[model samples]
Target: MVEEQEKRRSSEDEIDLIELTRSIWAGRLFIAKVTSVFIIIGLIIAFTSPVEYEATCKLLPESQEAQMPSLGGLAGLAGLAGVDLSSMGGSSGVMTPQLYPEIVNSLPFILEVMNDTIYFERQDIHATSFNYFKNIVKPSVMGYILKYTIGLPGLIFSNKPEDIISTKDDLSFYRISKEDWRLIESFKERIILEIDSETGIVEVMVEMPDPYAAAQIAKKIELMVTGAVVEYKTGKSLKNLEFILEAHDESKRKYESVQYQLARSTDRNRNVNSATAQIELKKLEYEFNLAYEVYKGLSSQVEQAKIKLKEETPVFTVLEPVRIPGDKSKPKRAVILIVLMVMGCMIGTIILFCKFILVGKRGRSF
Candidate 1:
């Protein structure tokens, strides 16, 4: 008796699946029409979307300051008090690679990028990144729609553009008004920065409409960050170099003066046969030796300072040089069309399934 009931339920399940499949097959034309409409829409969107070019750069940040002669020194003693010796270019640990993204996105770093002059090959024009964004870069159709429609409230409340006054010598003095500030902040969206912990490599990527500009921006940000790191690491070493240079110069002058005086004294009393002459010669010898030793010590210090500077200035080894991507990084037209088509087909299939079930053809099975 149980075996017979199981067979009946199995037969009902098979019939329900067949009916569903048949219902889907009968409305295949409707499914095709809906899918075609979505595909057309997808094509329109894919073609109209802005083509974005990506530029990528990778670098390894190396700290060689500890290799400088006697890097630990008295900084080791001061470390007991929780004092950071990095301020004096000593034993303190170097900045971690993780904060590189923050540095790259920082206001000063972006400003440095803005000050750079780049040629937009496609547009056949020369302009700073900031100026190009301000005067050029026309809005896309979608951007306009969003601004007036979905983003209408935010756009209405946004600050008005400011008329900045400036001249050739004072271009940097223009007050960055609220609207300009917002525009400048928008640069953060076009850049990406990351660090690979396992490999200890820094990667920076930039996107722009023009390939050349994209590549330039990537390289420019790399240079700015490199310069900043080098400057920070070698700050104390450079100052030490300056002080040693000055001391070396002064000691050299004193040594020369002593030699000159001794020469004059010997020449003036070359034939003297008295104790006074002997005492004068001894005094000049003592002064000359003192100046020579001081000069020699300063010379050695000068050399040491130079070596320290070289060691402290970190070398940013480029693991991957910035390359102009051959294809647009966005829009993925084929994928977009496939997704839209699949969505349309699913909707059409569901509509057919509901219509067939609600007509009472498969009501008994449910």
Candidate 2:
């Protein structure tokens, strides 16, 4: 009885060890199967993903003082009004030129970008293509659905427009506006504009799927923005100069009339009593001289305004030009293949392990 009991205990120990090993090794087949599924999906994704190309353009912003002379002008004007302009010229306040970059990235600028279909389409195609591969191609179940139903049909029948200009003519105004805004926002996020603190230069960078399009849009936008800046500044300067000219003309007429009167009085007076009259004449002469000086000053100011207006306009020099890229930036195939292969192996192994566990249990029970 003691030997039989010992044998039964040994048998129980063996069973426990086997169960422990099986449980650990169990569903490895499932893991392998899942991994295999992932690998295959990854491979398909890598293969089908579209290629993207990038283009970049660089530029520098204009001089800070030229861009925002209002603060300086107002300071000078305040001094003339007998107010202490220096105190009001707050150094703590934000600089006006710093706000320019924000204006460039503003909604209006973004809207302008949307109005151009070429920019919008390039952004959309790149984004949508990547999303499709990542979400639809990677999941095992989704992979099956895509392969059996969507994949082949999409390759053959997908009618995604090649570029934005081609699609815009077909889209209604509302549709165009909506799609364009979306693309603009996306492009804005991708594009960068920076001002160098030390040199006060502006750097602009735009990244797009089409290298040429990216370069083209960057150049076009820079020119548009520069033209706008020039137009606005020039208009203000011209108006100021017009007023200055009018004031100068009025002062000149006054000065000339006074000088003529003074000249006639000096010629006619020849007696000792002419001394008192001469003093009066000298006083009027002084007034005339003062008016003449003011007119001269204003004329000089008009010339200065013209120069400032010209200099303030932003100018761009292309540092880099976009060229046709030989390679696309998208659809990394090797990564996708490795991921899918691992998934497939995990899935297949899990199935094999489940069968092994169930069969071994049934034989032992029988």
Please identify model 1 stretches exceeding 4 Å from their true place: 1-34, 63-93, 161-178, 273-283, 347-366
- lDDT of predicted model 2: 0.59
Off by over 4 Å in 2: 1-33, 60-101, 117-184, 187-203, 224-291, 303-326, 335-366
Name the 10 consecutive residues with the lowest summed lDDT in model 2: 85-94
Per residue, candidate 2 scores C-alpha lDDT tens digits across 1-366 of 999999998997798668756764775665665776687667666765545555555555444454456557754654464434333221122234356567678765665654554433434443332233333224345446665685676557545443443324766333233334444565577566676677655566665555655665666666766666656545665576678778878877887887787777767764547667878877877877887787667766655554454444444555655454556655567766776676577556656656666877898799
lDDT of 1: 0.80
lDDT of every model, 2 decimals: 0.80, 0.59
Q: Per-residue alpha-carbon lDDT of model 1 for 158-239, expressed as tens digits? A: 7664554343674555556665686778877899998888978899999888999999999888988888777777777788
TM-scores, each model vs. reference: 0.76, 0.46
lDDT score of residue 342 within candidate 1: 95
